[model samples]
Target: MHITLIVPTNGRPSLVSRLLAHLERQTLHPDHVIVSATTPNDIEVRPDISFKVSYVFGDPGLCAQRNRAMALCDGTTDIISFFDDDFVPCDSYLETLSRVFREHPVYAVVTGDLLADGAQGPGLGFDEAVAMLDAYRPSSLPAHVRDHPGAYGCNMSIRAQVIGDLRFDERLPLYGWQEDIDFTSQLRAHGRIVNIGQLWGVHLGAKGGRVNGVRLGYSQIVNPIYLIGKGTMQRWFGIRLICRNLVANTLKSLRPEPYIDRRGRLKGNMIGFAHVLTRRADPEHILKL
Candidate 1:
């Protein structure tokens, strides 16, 4: 099965380079690898690579960059995978995905497990990432493939034909919070979205080329609400997300975590909650806060 890999990045050249290095070791090489950046200078490519590599530039938004990469895929491409620039895939990542798609024709979307520091956080050196992958025992995971609610943007693949005309909702704006939910939820209507426990990768969760904590926090509150208004996310689900983040940020603010910017996020969450209380919360207003 021919595959096209799309990586949307901003200003993290080293991280992107590291991800590419991991892809080089994949047992199943992609027919093409597209690196879509916010600007031409956001990435640098090496002259030598086994597979075809293409670089494209667009406005600096995750959804926008991904849409641009999607447009660049060859017509013959069967599977199109999207991976974050900071994610490090296991050696057999593509091989596992290819096998799964070939075996399960009913699935429209497939996502894998993401490991980071024994938890779901990021930032692993190249050697460390490889070691973790070597140590992971897929046999221990449950054998059954189960239906998933939606695809995780960090490492997910979809049938190229299934996503023929669907594009991410640009209305979600920069960083495009919950854009995966908005996109994959629509894809669910076409076929099953499954989570393959055996297929796993590491999310480096590098703290760069990302928006400030305030903006992320604002989106955390507003994006879900926006999706609810758009009739994509259930109202209760959105409320649950808001409450969860607010409570987490509130608690963390009292005792900040090492990797998280708790204070900034808490301030932003409070601002968002205040806007909601005044009946003035809007996704567009998030930038102004």
Candidate 2:
């Protein structure tokens, strides 16, 4: 299978370089790798790597960058895999994906198990993530697969043919909150989206290139609702998601974590609610913030 890896990044040239180096070490290397960024400075190209690496500049947003990268895929490509700049996968990650896709023809999309996801808490350092991946060993157990509403953005792949005309929603803007869900929901009609345990990775969730807390918080509330209205997300799921983030941000603001800007997020959540009540909520508004 010819796999093309696409990584959309911003404001972290060194980190993107490091991820490219890791891709060189994959047991089954990608046939091609495309790094899409907002500006040339957002990535540092290294010609020394064995795998083919193509760097391109696009509008400054995750969804836009990803769409720009996808436009580069050619007829020979079988699978299109997306990885965040900070995600580090096991050496066999690509190999496992090939095996699963070959064995299960019903799956149109696949996301991996995350060994350590720093996005859930404080972010992890590159060295720490590398050490964690190095110490790990593949499970002897058979690969476990589960149905999912959407693939996780950090490490996911889709059959290129299934994505014939679909693209990331550009309105999601920076960080493209819940973009995976929105895109994968559209994909679900083509084939199944599954989580495969064997195709695992570590998401460092590096904090340096993230959107501001206010914008991200606003996205947390507004984007889900936007998706719900578009029929990409269930209304109940969207409401629960908003409530969970809003409540957590509000309560955490009272005694904020050192690594998180809880107060700023709470304020953004309030702003999102205000906009929603006035029928002015839009994911693109994050650009103004």
Residues 1-289 of candidate 2 have per-residue lDDT tens digits of 9999999999999999999988877889999999999899998878789988898896788889999999899999999999999999988999989888888889999999999999988999888988998998877988788998898999999988899788999989888999999998898988999998887889998888888899989999999989999999888878999999989998899999888889889888989999999999999998898
Residue 158 displacement in candidate 2 (angstroms): 0.3
For model 2, what is the alpha-carbon lDDT of residue 63?
Answer: 89
Q: How well does candidate 1 score on lDDT at residue 4?
A: 95
Candidate 1: C-alpha RMSD to true structure equals 2.0
Model 2 CA lDDT for position 222: 96
Q: Which stretches of candidate 2 lie over 4 Å from their true place?
A: none
What is the lDDT, from 0 to 100, of the residue 23 in candidate 2?
80
lDDT by residue (tens digit), candidate 1, 114-179 = 766322344566678778888977775456677866788888899988997999987766778788
Top candidate when judged by TM-score against the true structure: 2
Candidate 2 global Cα RMSD? 1.0
Per-model TM-score, in order, reads 0.93, 0.97
